[model samples]
Target: MLKKVRGTRKKATLGHIRQETVYLAIQALQKDESLSIQLLCEIAGIARSSYYKWLNRKPSACELENEQLTQVMLSIYEKVERTFGYRQLTLHMRKQTGKKINHKRVYRLMKLRGIQSVIRRKRAKYVRSTPQQVAENVLNRKFEATAPNEKWVTNVTEFKYGHGQKAYLSAILDLHDKSIVSYVLGHSNNNPLVFQTLKQALQAAPGSKPMLHSDRGFQYTSLDFKKLLDKNELFQSMSRVGRCIDNGPMESFWGTLKCEKYYLHKYETFQDLKKDVENYIHFYNNERLQAKLNGLSPMEFRNKAA
Candidate 1:
């Protein structure tokens, strides 16, 4: 009779253990972690052998927490406008949560979630203008001059607005000191445009008939432009067709202007663009340092020379 009573107590205890196991498995499933029979057994302090007995069990609290982290990562990617790759996303996560996470983990998450960026292609190419008559290559790529106004190169470039409106920029650069002797902004890039720039340059450098060089653009070949050069007693030089090397200094000036300042900002009106261009030219001459001038600005180097 005592042995039978002991057996009954043992059976009741086993029944209680099974009920607790079922309750833990349900809790694990709600938590969203990888809920398997094995994980549930581990959470409930049961043996692996015992877990296999309940092979069709659900997820535990740990698995649920892992799923929540993934959802949070996805939300972050969406919030950043989908532009951020894994590195940036990882940084964002750390900043938001104050928790340091590995970049590789973030990358893997992004890959699994299929994140990417859109690629853009070039729009159009500029065609070089063909001139009726080519001018002589007088300077022959010699960029240096001993005195101011000895050698000058001129060029014009255009900036576009929405559909049809545009502004033209003409510049005359003194190659000797690499200074912008004169510049003009106009509605059209024509003979009048460049001739006006040349007139200003000639007036600025009084008593000097500089050897002026330019590309074979039509503006440079126009009769009015040539007559003005003749009137000032300045010799005319030109680059060979499609050969930018002949007017390398002027080309370099254009490159520096566009790359350093103009390309970075969008101009709303022609006048605003003109004002900014003037400001940049002033800065280029007076403030901005040039490696070619031994770390001195054009104005500084020229002043020292004087």
Candidate 2:
């Protein structure tokens, strides 16, 4: 009669027992004095033989190492706010621990842990504008440069903070090392904002005549902007109307900045937003490693080349 009652209870509870739950019950047997081995096995819909086998089996060396590596990956994942995918995380883990960890292994471990990088938000559509005049597409998608300041691309991106207030970021990227030569944040995307960005770049790299490329924005097409470029003897190049990819490198940088940093937070004040933008740019130049640059940051690549 007792055996019949036990069978009925076990059958009723077995439907709810998952493999994960069975594992948990096995673990609990070690800590809970009231959980008898036989009862756990019955409740988990597993044979006493299977429970004993799992309990006596020791983890392999590879399994133990994978557990440890998963913990390290978690630390890095949180440190970067999950901004890095498995590839970048692997590079970072190798640098920090000097362990020649394979990226494939890292990818497998990250998958098991359900750790992943953030998804990038798609950028807004480009508004085609008819300019009175535009410079030749002198850049012609020749994005690579053999030396610093040889080819430069400039663009302005907008950000919002606190009740629809907008901030404009104008910056120049040197194609040689992908470094931001100069950047300016302003309340308005006016001619002055772009001019100041240009002025700063000119001052930063005095006597360097480079091809400066930009989109057909009003500021970039202005007469004043042309005069300033001519004064510095810079070759002015403009992207075709609605063709953002003409300045692909510069657009790529913006996407990186937005995906990795700007989109991660909300700012209540312009001051807070500006401070974060400045910090991210500094990190990008100094700390963030690039695969194309042989795992060096932008500034590192530039300095090594120099």
Candidate 1 wrongly placed segments (more than 4 Å): 1-132, 162-164
Cα lDDT of model 2 by residue, 162-273, tens digit: 9999999999999999999999999998999999999999899999999999999999988888988888899999988778899999999998899888899998899999
> Candidate 1 lDDT (Cα, whole model)?
0.74
Q: Best by lDDT, which number?
A: 2
In order, what lDDT does every prediction score?
A: 0.74, 0.86
Candidate 2 wrong stretches, greater than 4 Å: 1-57
TM-score, every prediction: 0.58, 0.82
- Clash pairs detected, candidate 2: none
CA displacement after TM-score superposition, residue 13 of candidate 2 (Å): 32
Q: For each of the candidates, give the backbone clash count.
A: 10, 0
Tens-place lDDT digits, model 1, residues 1-306 = 999999998777566556544654545574676566556667667676754544445757944554565687778766534544665566556655666667766765554445653232222335766665557898898999998889999888877754558998999998867999999999997888888898788789788998999988888877777878788888999988778878888877777676556665688788778887999899778865555675567898899999
Candidate that would win on TM-score: 2
